[model samples]
Target: MVRELFNSIAKRYDLVNRLTTLGLDKRWRRKACEIALTYVDVKKPRILDVACGTGDMIMCMRKRLERRGIPAKFYGLDCSERMLEIAKKKVPFAELKVGNAEEILFPDGSFDLVSVAFGLRNFSDREKAIGEIHRVLKRRGILLILEFSRSESLLGKLTWFYTRSVVPIIGGILTGNREAYNHLWRSIETFPSPEELSMEFEKRGFKVLTMEWFFPRIAFVMVLEKV
Candidate 1:
C-alpha cells in the first residue's frame, strides 16, 4: 500500500516535500548526514540508504562527503520502482535497487553507515526492518534515522496541526491524491516517540548515541552505533 502510494506520487514527491516542509527537508537531511559523518571511520565508507526516496539522503550524504574530499560508495534501496527510477536520475553514480527494508538484500556487516529519512514509519514491520539494518552494519557502524515524532508541547501541537491538516490538503491539491498524504499523516500519528524509539534501538543491540529534535519537536534525528 505504501509502495503503491509512493509510486503514484513519484513524479511530484520532491515538489510535495518542498511545499510541505517549506524547504526544510533539505536542511534536515543535511543535519542527518552531518551527524553521520562524525561516526564514519572509513575514507571510502560503504553507505546504504534504505527507502531512499528520490535519492535525497544519498545525494545529501555524497555532497557533504565530497565537499570534505572524503570518498564514499553509495547504495540506495526502496520498494517503489518509480521512486527508484527518479532516484537513479538524481544520483546516477549511486547504486539504486528495488528492495524491501524489512528484508535487506545486502550481506551482514556490509555497511559502515545505514540511513533512512522519513521512511521508517512506512515500513510494515519497523522492528524487523531495524534488525535487518543492524545485521548489515559493520561493528561500530552507525544507523541514522530522521523521522516524525508524536508531538506534545504547545509549539509541537501547532506543528502537528499543520502536518495533520495543512500538509494533506496541500498535497492533495498538488498531487491530486489526498489519500496518500492521509496515510502519511496517519503514520506520523501512530509512530513512536523519540524516547520510545531509542529504547527499541537499545533492545535491538544498538547504543543510542543521540536522539535530538531539530525544530518544533515534531521531527527528530536518532543516531545509534552497533554494539
Candidate 2:
C-alpha cells in the first residue's frame, strides 16, 4: 500500500513536500547533513541513506561533503522503484537499491554512516530495521534520523492542526492522493515521542549523541552511535 502510494505520487512528491513544508524541509535536511558531517572523520566515508526519497538527503550531504573535499561514497535504498527512479536523476552518483529497511541487503559493517529522513515511521518493523542498521554500520558508526514527533507547545498545536487538516487537502489537490497524506499525518500522530525513540536506540546498543528538535518541537534530528 505504501509503495504503491509513493509510486503514484513520485512525479509530484518533491513538489508536494516543498509546498506542504513551505520549503523548510530543505533547510531541515541541510541542517541534518551539517550535523552528520561533523562525525565524519574518515577520508572516504561510506554513507547509506535508507528510504531515500527523491535523493534530496543524499544529494545535500554529497554537495556539502564535496565542498569540504571529503569524497564520500553514497548509497540509497527505497522500496518504491518509482521513487528510486526520481532519486537517481537527482543523485546520479549514488548507488541505489530497492529493498526493505527491516531486511537490508548489504553486508554487515558496510557503511560508516546511515541516515533516514521521515522514513522510519513507515517501516513495517522499526526494531528489526534498527537491528539491521546496527548490523550494517561499522562499529561506533553514526545513525542520523530526521523525523516528526508529537509536540504540545502552542506552535506545535498549530502545526499539528495544519498537518491534520490542511496537509491532506493540499496533498490531495497536488498529488490526487488524499489518503496518502492522511497516512502521513496518522504516522506522525502515532510515532514515538523523541525521548521514547531515544530509549529504543539505547535498548539496542546505540548511544544517543544528540537529540535536537526543530522549532516547535514537531520534528527532531537524532544522532546515535552504534555501540
Candidate 3:
C-alpha cells in the first residue's frame, strides 16, 4: 500500500516538497547533508542513504564533495522503483535501487557511513531496520538521521498546525493524493522523539554523539556512531 502510494506521487515528489515547505526544503536537505558530513570526513566517505526518495539529500552532499575534487561512494535505496527511477535522474552518478531497509543486502560492515533523511517515520519495523543499519555499517561508522522532532513553542505549534493541515491541502491539489500527504503528516506524529531515538540507538549498541536542532520545536539532525 505504501509502495503504491509513493509510486503514485513519484512524479510530483520534488514539486510537492518545495511547494509544501515554501522552498525551505532545499536548505533543510543541505543541512541534513551538512550534519551527515560532520560525522565522517567528506574527502572520501562511503555513504549509504537508505529510503533515499528522489535523492535530493545524496545530490546535496555530492555537490559539497565536488568542491575539493573528492567523490562520495553514495548509494541511494528505496522500496519503490518508481521513486528510484525519479531519484536516478536526480542522482545520476550514484547507485539507486528498490530495496528494503530492514533486509539490506550488502555484506556486514559494507559502508563507512549511513544516513536516512525524513524517511524513517515510514518504516513499519523501525527496530529491525535499525538493526540492519547496525549490521551493514563498519564498526564505529557514523549514522546520520534527520527526522522530525516535536516543537512545543507557540511558533512551533502554529507551524505544526499548518504543516498538518495546510501543507496536505496544497500537496493534495498539486499531487492529487491528499491521503498520501496526510499519511506523511501522521508519520511525524507517530515517529519516535529525540530522546526515544537516542535510547533505541544505545540499546542496539550505538552511541549518540551529536544532536543538532534547526528549530527547538520539532526538526533535528542526530548523529550517532556504531559501537
Candidate 4:
C-alpha cells in the first residue's frame, strides 16, 4: 500500500512536499546531513539512504560533503520503482536499488552512516528495519532519522490540525490523490513520539546521540550511534 501510494505521487512528490511544508523539508534534510557530517571522522565515508524517495536526502548529503571536500560513496534503497526512477535522475552517481528497509541488501557493517528522512513511519516493521540498519552499520556508525512526532503543545495542536485537515486538501488538489495524503496524516497520528522512538533504537543496541525538534515540536531529527 505504501509503495503504491508513493509510486502514484512520484511525479509530484517533491512539489507537494515543498508546497505543504513551505520548503522546510529541504532545510530539515540539510540539517540531518549536517548532523551526520559532524560525527563522520573517516576520510571517505560510505553512506546509505533507506527509503530514499526522490533522493532528496542523498542529494543534500552529497552537496554538503562536496562543499567540504569530503569524498563519500552513496547508496540508496526504495521500494517504489517510480520513486527510484526520479531519485536516479536526481542522484545519478549514487547506487540506487529497489529494496525493503526490513531486509536491506547489504553486507554486515557496510556503511558508515545510514539515513532515513521522513520515511521511518511508513515502514511496515520499524523494529525489524532498525535491526537491519544496525546490522549494516559499522561499530559506532551513525543512523539519522528525520520523522514526524506527536506533540501536545498549542502550536503542535494547530500544526496537527493543518496536517490532518488542510494538507490532504492541498495535496489532493495538486496530485489528485486525497487518500494518499490521508494516509500521511494517519501515519503521523499513529507514529511513536520522539522519546518512544529513541527507546526503540536504544533497545536495538543504538545509543541516542541527539534529539533535535523542529518548530512546534511536530517533527524531529534523531542521531544515533550503533553500539
Give model 1's TM-score versus the native structure: 0.98
Question: What Cα-based lDDT does every candidate model obtain?
Answer: 0.91, 0.93, 0.84, 0.93
Off by over 4 Å in 2: none
- Give the lDDT of residue 97 in candidate 1: 90
Q: Write the per-residue lDDT of candidate 1 for residues 1-227, one digit (tens) a residue.
A: 98889999999999999989999888888997898788787888999999998999999999999998999999999999999999989999999899999999999999999999999999999889989999999999999999988778998999999998999999999999999999987999888898888999899999988878888678899999999
Clashing pairs in 3: 149-218, 150-217, 151-217
TM-score for each of the candidates = 0.98, 0.98, 0.95, 0.98
Better of 1 and 2 by lDDT: 2
The RMSD of every model to the true structure, in order and in angstroms, is 0.8, 0.7, 1.5, 0.8
lDDT of 2 at 90: 88
Residues 128-201, candidate 2: write the lDDT tens digits: 99999999999999999999987888899999999999999999999998999999999999999989999999
Error of 3 at 171 (Å): 0.8
lDDT of 2: 0.93
User: Lowest summed lDDT over 10 consecutive residues: which window, candidate 3?
Assistant: 211-220
**Higher-ranked by TM-score: 2 or 3:** 2
Runs with alpha carbons beyond 4 Å of true place in candidate 4: none
- Residue pairs with backbone atoms closer than 3 Å in model 1 (clashes): none
Tens-digit lDDT string for candidate 4 (1-227): 99999999889999999999998888888887898789888889999999999999999999999999989999999999999999989999999999999999999999999999989999999989999999999999999999997789888899999999999999999999999999999999999899899999999999999989888667799999999
